[model samples]
Target: MGKISYYTEEGLNRLKAELTDLKTKGRAEIARQIAEARDKGDLSENAEYDAAKDAQGLHELKISKLEEVLANARVLDESTIDASQVSVLSKVKIKNKKNGAEVSYTLVSEEEADLKAGRISVGSPIGKGLLGKRVGDVAEIKVPAGVMEFEVVEIAR
Candidate 1:
């Protein structure tokens, strides 16, 4: 079994929709391509047929992976989240100890992470370091550059 991952209701719904689309429209498109290629005749010498077959294999693999991900997904109720400490779905404000810069990010599952929107994955280095930490606690995180220190300024749901 795959490891279980928690997601917000919206995130889980989005994932389910994507899986449904892949299983329906995606598979239909691939099947259509294969049918068109086969109509060319002489499958042994048709490069289009070979390419279509390869594409179908890749498409099925993607569907399988998506199914596995859905199987292990667990939706978490946002109302139950505690704001007293850093955790998934918590919007946390932190100050960089080195440069005195401040930024806020919402900790989310890997599937919901969008850095441009200030959403980060709890599996990330900084997120992991901040997990379970309360305001006024310092988190030391190791990144590709080096170890950086950040002080938790606030946590909110």
Candidate 2:
């Protein structure tokens, strides 16, 4: 069994949509490529055929992985989330202790993480450090650069 991961409604829906697209449109496209390559000539000497076959394998692997993720995914109700502490789906504002720069990030599942969108995976170093921390708490996170200190400024659903 895969480890269960919590997601927001929008994130779960997006994952389902992607899985559907991969199984339908994505599989059809790969099948078409394989057929076209097969029609060219001998399979042994045809690099296109080999490439198409490889692509099909990769595509199927992606589908399988996605299915597993969906199976273990549980949607978290925003209303039920605790606003007092940082956790998955919690929008947290943290201030860098050194520079006093503040940034907001929503903790999400690995599949739902998008740095540009201010969503971060709970598995990330910073996210792990911030988990369960309440406002005014300091989180010491170890990144590739070094250990950085951040103070939890706010937590919201």
lDDT of 1 by residue, 38-147 (tens): 99999999999999999999999999998999999999887787779999999999999999999999999999999999999999998899999999999999999999
TM-score of each: 0.97, 0.95
| Cα TM-score of candidate 1 | 0.97
Off by over 4 Å in 2: none
What's the lDDT for candidate 2? 0.95
Model 1 segments more than 4 A misplaced: none
RMSD of each: 0.8, 1.0
Candidate 2 lDDT, 45-122, residue by residue in tens: 999999999999999999999999999999898788778999898999999999999999999998889999999999
Error of 1 at 145 (Å): 0.5
TM-score of 2: 0.95
